[model samples]
Structures are given as structure tokens and as C-alpha cells.
Target: MSEQQKGPAGGGPGGQRPGGPAPGNFGFGPGRGGPGAMGMPVQKAKDFKGTLRRLTGYLRPYRFSLLIVILTAVLSTVFSIVGPKIMGKATTKLFEGLMGKIKGTPGAKIDFHYIWEILAVLGILYIISALFSYIQQYVMAGVAQKTVYGLRKDVNEKLARLPLKFFDSRTHGEILSRAVNDVDNISGTLQQSLTQIITSVVTLIGVVVMMLTISPLMTLISIVTLPLSFVAIKMIAKRSQLYFKGQQKALGELNGHVEEMYTGHNIVKAFGHERKSVDKFNSVNEELYQSGWRAQFVSGMIMPIMGFIGNIGYVLVSVAGGILVLHKTITIGDVQAFISYSRQFTMPITQTAQIANILQSTVASAERIFELLDEKEEVPEAATPIAVVQKESEAVPGKAIKARGDVSFNHVQFRYKEDTSLIEDMDIHVHSGQTIAIVGPTGAGKTTLINLLMRFYEINNGSITIDGVGITQLKRGDLRNLFGMVLQDTWLFNGTIRDNIAYGRTGATEEEVVAAARAAYADHFIRTLPEGYDTVLNEEASNISQGQKQLLTIARAILANPTILILDEATSSVDTRTEIHIQRAMNELMQGRTSFVIAHRLSTIRDADLILVMNHGTVIEQGTHEELLAAGGFYADLYESQFSSRKRQVDAV
Candidate 1:
């Protein structure tokens, strides 16, 4: 891969986790970098209203559950809000009784019964409030998961439908960041922030109403300081935002540097670049520390400063309430209740401020997800597919019986970009049961030809056909099922060897899997492993040698039993001895089947029925090996060059 294709060292910024203080410590439920996270950089969507509306559509299916969540949240906050006022009545009764008793009045006795009843009522109210809160959380949790489940499912389906160019144009990390990290951001916001926003707003309004009923003058005094809290938050957030962005960027750089260094540590050590690598790591690490701490410090000032301002308001409300009590305008109980309301007032105000930032980031994440979901999918599949017959008499089971591997590309024109042509007026016709070899240098559009053949890309003009039926007339799945491919790079998932091989065919019996392995000369290696066919391949299949992995992929292709075989440098990774054995096995597999062999080693295609020498995406010469050499053309020159290179190697040995 080129440096451009590998992308940056730290993956991408969206994929990195925070490298400093845990976001949860700031009262954010998770490191969502969204609501209630003060220092985290806010990310606003380009189309905030549109993205938010689309995000809301995900919740449409759970409208009933959301209704329940909203009702429960409102009920819970209202119950809790009314508690402080009702308890104040008990306080007033106690105060009046004490004053009477001090004067030695006969009837002046503390009302223990009334006080006890008040306590019981308060406990029940709290219990009901707790129950409603629990119900809200439960219902919202379900709604959040189901909503995201649908969104994730849509993203997954979109990925499969996307053309190869879509993946080629972006880094793997970038795609994964949008699909996984961005989707997770939306999920976290839906699960926690959505409900919290509702409750905070409700609590703020309810607290004000209750406070007003106690003492309007005190309520006014308490709320007058609210703007100070907002101002402090705005000032702090504005200053800290830059550092938070720096912290995120620096963290991504550090992560990418570390990952790149670790993955290529062997090369680094061999080249004695350890010191340089360490110096680079230290540089990025230092940047992360600088930005992280600065963001934390600036954001940390918010709570203390908000508290200081809140304390001033508290002092003012207390003095005002005391004067009112003395003037007999309000009871002592009203003073106590009003003070509680004042304290409660500041919490939601702070929460509201924090949540505003969070919603912006959350909307940004949603916009990214929506962009992916809205990407144009592979040109829609054929609405009415032409059915192809399957015949057991075909050379291989499950082969394309109608075509017998007859393929023709008619005056095909293609270009990856509009400004440059890759393949122009390309034409090829392969007869059934013939071995056709495609020889070309690197970047000569060799792989691109195969990609076009399989419809991984669509041609700009002309058509590809199988047995006179246009390829586009069949469903993509049907078109691809006609051929089997073995490329230089082998791909195998983390699974038992048997399962990986069986992946080529649905419901393939264990007997057929072993037989296919034997045909590819892979059975000997399989039996040598500790668990044989049951041995599980680790991620990357690193437990096996490169040659063995290639053999396994060959076995998978053999099991597919396709009539049109594509061998793209299939034996490039094996030793000469192994290559000879594989060549013989492939020769037998290719009998009565059309095969397209792409190889740089001229010796491998010497026996090909028809050899096409390609250059600059156009075929320079085409003929049988003996006929091509007799013609003394481009094919002859390419073959002679490889032969002379091999003779030199032999002479040196």
C-alpha cells in the first residue's frame, strides 16, 4: 500500500478516545463528549435542524415508549418539587407550638402526631417519585437501544451495497469512525442526555413555581444571580473549547504514532530508529498533556466560580427571608423551604448550560451518520434477473451451466476519474474450456479489469456478457457466483479451518471440504496442524504461514466449484517446489473450465491456450505462446526478458 492509502499514523481524530481526565468525572454519564461535558469541544452540525429532524425520525417507531418516558419524568420531578413545600407546613406547626409552650399556655404542646404524619407523607412522595424515575429510565433505555439498532442495521446494509470506489476513496478508520463512533455518540445522547434534558427543564420550571408560592421576593432574589452562572459558563467554555480541540487532535496524533510504531516496530528496530520513534512519541505525548491539562484547568474553574456566585445569592435570599419573617409576612417554615428552592435552582441552570453544548456535539455526530446512510448505493440490482440453469453434468458442481465459462467484453471503456482514461475500447472474447492468461506490469489496470468483469465497478460504455446474456441483466450475486477467484492476498476470518473453507459453499458437507483441500494440495498441511480441520485461524490468520494461508484460500475457491476460474498470482507466495505441485493441481482443476490467469512470471503461463500481453490497459499482442514467440512481438519480448532474468539467477546460484 502507498503512504497515501495507509492514511495518518493515529487513524483519525473521530476514532480516538480522550487521552486525559475521564469525562465521567465532569458529571457526563459517559465519555460521549456531549451534554454535561463542559471542557469537551462542541461540534455543531452543518445542518443542525435537518440532522436533528432526521435523528428524531429514528425515534418515531418508539413514540409510545417515549410518551411514557416523558410522562414519568414529568411526574417524578413534580412529586419531588412539591415535597419541599409540604414539609415546610410541618416546620411551621412545630415552630408555633414551641412559641406557645415557652409562654406556659395550657394547650401549648408540640404536635408530635402532626409532625409524624408529615414525615410519612414525605416518605411516600419520595417513594412514588423514585418509582416514576425508575420507570422512565427503563422505558427510555429500551427506546434508545431499539432506535440505534435500526440505525446500525441501516448503516450495515448501506456498507454492503456501496461500490468498491466508495471504500477506495476513504480510509478504513474514517468509515469505521462514522459507522461505530458516530453511531455510539448518537446512542449515548438518546439514552441519557435526552431524558436528562427533559427532567432538568421541568425541574427548573417547577422549582421556580414552588419558590414563588413561598415568597416571591425570595424567588426573585434567588433567580437574579442565574445570569451570572450562565455568563461564567459561557466565558469558561469559550476559552476551554480551543484547548479541548487541541487535546483531541493531539491524542489522535499520539494514538496514530503509537499504533504505527508498534505495528512496524520490527522494521524500526532493524533500522535502528528506536531513538527517533521515542522522540516522536515524547513530542506528541507532551502536546497531549499540555492541551489536556489546560482544558481541564479552565473547565474546572466553572464549578467553583458558579458555586461562589450561588453563595452570594444564598446570602441575599436568607436576609430577605428573615426580614419578611420578622414582619410576619411569611412563616419560619417558608424561609427554610425557599432556601432549598434557591439551591435547587442553580443545579438545573448549570445542567441546562452544559447540555446545550452536548446537544451540539450530538447533532454533529448524527449528521455524519446520516451522510453515510444517504450515500448512493451500487447502481440498483436488476429488477428482473434472468435465470441461469444449473446442471450436475458440469465440470464442477454449482457451476454456471448455461455459459460453460464463455465471457466476452465488447468495446468496454472505463476510467476511475473523468480526466484520465484507464481502459479504452477494450475488447476480449474467451471460448469455453480455454486457459486465457493476462500479463501486465503493475498499475496496468490488471486488477481493474477483473473488478470490471465482476461488476465491482461498472464500465463507462459497452457491455460484458456470459453466454450472450448481458451481465447487467443478472443480479450481482448471480453474476459473481459464476466465477471463483484466488488472488495474491488471502483473506480468512477468525474461525475453524473447516468453517473458513466451507464459507465458499452453503451447507457444504465435511467430506467435500477435505476433498477440495486435497485438490488444492492443502490437505497435507491441514492434517499436520494440531487440530487439523478444526484448528481455528486467529485474526489475520497469523498462526499460519503466508503460503499456508494462500493454500487455504485456494481450497476455498476449489470448493466453490466455479466454471470460470480466476488465478491472480495465486502461486506467487509459495516456494518453487510448492508452486510446481500447485500448478499441477490447478491444471487438473482447469480441465473443461475457462480460466483467466494473471501472472508476472512468464514461465507460469507458457502452456496457456491464448496469452494476451497488456500494456497501458490495452492488449498489445494476443496468441498462443509458441505462436506469440514466432510473431516476435511484445509477448515475445516480455517472455524473453523473464527467461534471461531467470538464467542469470541460475548462473549466479
Candidate 2:
């Protein structure tokens, strides 16, 4: 029967929107240095305490080791802090002895023996401090690495569970940035900044305690500079935070541009858009440069500003201590020690200020990583999954029923977005063994239909069934195992030809792989290669011809050997002679299987048992090829147009 239907549909050619942004857009609109274009949005953690708590959960497993690291950091800082005070004692002893000797008093010689003892003690303390510092670093390294290992593992697992819609909405580079750059930033902060924070706090506390013992007045002088130091830090850090966030966003955009342009270099050159591409790159690069230097310059100001504040404190303490020593209110040794503690005091404050600045960037990175981990995942599997059993031969009397390849779509409705209703009230059925060819114009929802069948995107309403069981009742993995697919865009990893073919069926034997290749008419050409079946495909499989890649994918599908087969323009890239051979091999493979073919070349499916004509998103006509041609409808017009176009091209040649 033939039918006609009308609906509102909006997808463009090849299931993409027509008149969409160009590839150079990179998901960021024009005005490269504009507010949003200058950088990616920084996602601040909603609850800093909660995020820190979650991050610390990863550290709980190694708490004992971390405790030892903390202890070592404390010991190292304490030992270093005590050294300056002890050295001051030796300084006072020498000064007293020199004054006595210059006055020519009896038994007034300098105490070389006491000085040697102090020097020996100071040397031992330095060595002990260094040893403890090394130990703290070693232990913290292991803890930091282990924590990030768990984080990276969780992110990867979360990626596998996420639905296809999540991927469709994001650029590949954005996802990769989260996985690589964001996680790495967390790792670096844990490894270095965590330890710095611990040491700075401990050193600050120990120096303050020692300084009080030497001269409380001198300590008060040192404390007066704190407000000025904090004010400078607060102002500079506030400004730098904005630039740092901008720097990260610009970096991600630049990375996205590089990845997209390099992957599609051939297309850009073919369209003579190289100059345009270069201009896009320059725009992004300039934004990155401006943000990066501003961030560095602002952060760089912190050290010097803190240093100036520290020197002001140092000179004040020194002058006050010197006056007190002259009045005999404090020993020269005490004054010397107070000056050393004053210097030590400001060092930790400066370091702590810098650490605060570093943490801003670190938190921004962690937020990005957490965002990816929190994406909505695919629908959960059935609580009670049904098994799919495919029967190869006559069924045994007591065995489970076999999957017969009968499929049905009942009142299905779907849309990519809320505004676009692409499919509505669609109904279809196929017998156990039938060849159904689907024909449609560009953007007619051809690929969308295949996506629903495979459950890549769930239908908004209705149900699809395999045999007599609804697909939702079956585990997605089990449902997918029942079908074999070959698409127009071939996907091959960076591996040998043999490895690519064997990927169809896990643990497939070498002989089986070879047989599959031969059946697809790919074995002869593979043998002619320099490395035969061992020839390696580069990234994107560019080392091989497009026809060869298509053939290899067919071989992969043949090896899968499912009860149902789906081929979407599978042979569109091959030559006429190669197409003939592929058609013969596919015919053999489709002997007893249910086959669904989608083709733009109407000639390819003339022999199909059923031909489906679709427009917009509805199935308008269904019948044998001859029956549709006699009806003089949409199918007839489509067939005639393609036929005439091909004839004109051939005649011209």
C-alpha cells in the first residue's frame, strides 16, 4: 500500500541542522575577544567544603601514610626554626670573650672549644631537617598519586555510562580537557600545594613561639606589618583570580580549535578555507596571550609586595633589638636570634599567600572534572533482564525459544529537542527473513530511525520489540548483540588490519578472521599491502584508501554474523567494480538474515522484498520496487530523478 503524510520536521542534510555555525565556530560564536569568547565559563564549586570533603574521601584509604608525612613535616620545620636561636647563643659567647680579651684581662681568651661545640650541633640539626623534609616529600608523593589514580578511574568509568546525548551536546576537545587537563591540575595541587600548605603553617607557628621567648617587644614589631601584607595580598589575588579563570577558558577554546582544525584539514583545504582557519587560530591565540600574561603579571606582584612588607618588619625589629642590647635589657645573642625569627616569620606568610592564589586555579579545574563526572547517565538496564537466544538450526524440543529476527515498531514518537518532533505515530513490521530498503531525501530522519532501533537515543514514546519481546525488557548489551551494522563513515583504530577485523567477535580465531575478509572481497587487497594483514592503520586510517577502509568494515560486520543486519550507505565510497563484488558478498551474508539497507542510489535496492519511502519523518510509501514505480508517486519521482542524474553524468564522461 502507498500512503502520504505531513509533519513539522527541522533536521537538515545528514541529520544535522542546515545553515548552522561553521566548523571554525568551535561552539563559540563570532567576536573572538568578546566576554564569553575570550574564555570558557569557570564553574565554581557550589560547596567548597563539600567538594573538599569528597576529595578527602579519596585520601582516606591512605590516612596512615599521610599521618606519617604530616609528622615529618612538623619535625622538619621545628628543627629548622630552632637552629637560628642556637646559633645566636654562640654569637653572644664569642662577643663576650672578644671584649674581655681586648681589655687584656686574665683568662679572657675567646672560647674556641665552646664555639666548636655549637657549630657541631648546628650542623647536625640542619642534616636532620633535610632528612625529614625528604621523607615527607616521598610519602606525600605516593598518597597524591594514588588519590588521582582513583579519580581518573572514576572519570573514565563515568564516561562509559553516560548517554549519547551528552556527547552530542559537547565538543570532543571539551571532554578531553576535563579528562586530561582538569585531572592533571588536581594531581599537581595535591602533590605540591598540599605539602606547602602544611609546612607553611607549621613554620609560622614555631617561629612565632620562638620569637616570643627571645623578645616579646620585637615580636610585636614584626606583627605590626601583618595588616599591610594581607591588604596587598588581598587586592592582587582578587585581580589575578579573574585573569587566571580567563586563561583557563581561553586555553580550552584554543585546544578545541586545534583539535577540530587538524582533524578536518583535508576538508578545509578542499574548500580553500586555510586562510580563514589561520585567522580563527590567530584570534584564539591572541586571547590566550592577553589573559595568560595578565594572570602572570598579577600573581608575580605578590612576592615583591610581600617582600617589601617583610623588609619593613625586618628593619624595625633589628633597630629595636639593637637598642635593647645596648641598654643591657636583652643580650646580643637574644637580639641576633630575634632578627632571624623575624625573617622566618614573614617567609611563611608570603608562601601561604602564594598558595592561596594557586588554589583558585586548582579549584576551577576540579569543578570542571566534577561536572563531567556528574552528567546524566543512560537509562539503567532492566531489573530482570531477558536473554536473547538466536537459533542457527532446528530448535531442540526442550531448549529456550530462538530469536527469529522479527521486529516491530509500534506508535513510536521522538524528537531531538523539545521543539522539533521528527518522528510521530510511526508503525512498521518485518518478517523473520526479509530485505527492507529505506529511501528518503536528505534530512528525512534516515539515520535517526537507525539510532532509535539501536537504542542510542530512546524514543520519547511507544516501544520497539525484537521477536515478541519489548526491547526495554532486554539488556542493552544483549539487544545490540543480535544485530550487525556497517555505516558509511568507517571507524578503524590505530591497529593492524587483522586486529581491526577481529574486533567484531571477541576471541575470534585467525582462520575465522581470514574467512570473513575473503567473504567481503577485502582479503586480496589486504594481501597486496607491504605488511599484509599486519599492516597498521594510522590515526583515522588514512594510510589506506577510502574504498579499502569501507571493505574492511564490511569484513568486520560479516565476522559479527548477527541474526539481523543494518547497512547505511555501506558501499557508497567504492568504485563500480568494487561495488559489484561487495553486493555479491552482501547477498551471500544476507541469505537467511533480516536486512535493512539505507541507500541514496535507488538502483541498489530494486530487488528488495520491501521498499520504504520516507519524507520528513513519516513513512509515505511501502511496496516492492516495481509496485512503487507503477504507482507514480513520491518513490517514482525519486527513482526517476536519480536515474536521470546518473545517466547525464555518465554520458558527459
TM-score (all chains, Cα) for each model: 0.92, 0.84
What TM-score would candidate 2 get against the native?
Answer: 0.84
Residue-wise C-alpha lDDT for candidate 1, range 305-393, written one tens digit per residue = 98899899989988998899999999998898888888889898777767777788788878988899888788898887656534244
CA deviation > 4 Å runs, candidate 1: 1-31, 34-36, 388-403
lDDT of 1 at 233: 87
Give per-residue CA lDDT, model 2, range 1-653, as digits (tens): 00000001211112311122211122343211122221222344567766777777889999999999999999999999999999999999999999898998899978989999999999999999999999999999999999999999999999878876776776665677677666776787788889989999999999999988988898899999999988887787678768867776777678768777887899999999999999999998999899878877776787788788889998898899889988998889888888888878877877675566455556766767788888888888889775445555444565545778888989999998899899998899988889999999998878788778877778999989888788888777777777787777767777899998887888889999999999989999999999999999986688998788878877887888888888778778889887887787788778898988998899999999998888899899999999999999999999999999999999999
lDDT of 2 at 568: 78
Highest TM-score: give the candidate number.
1
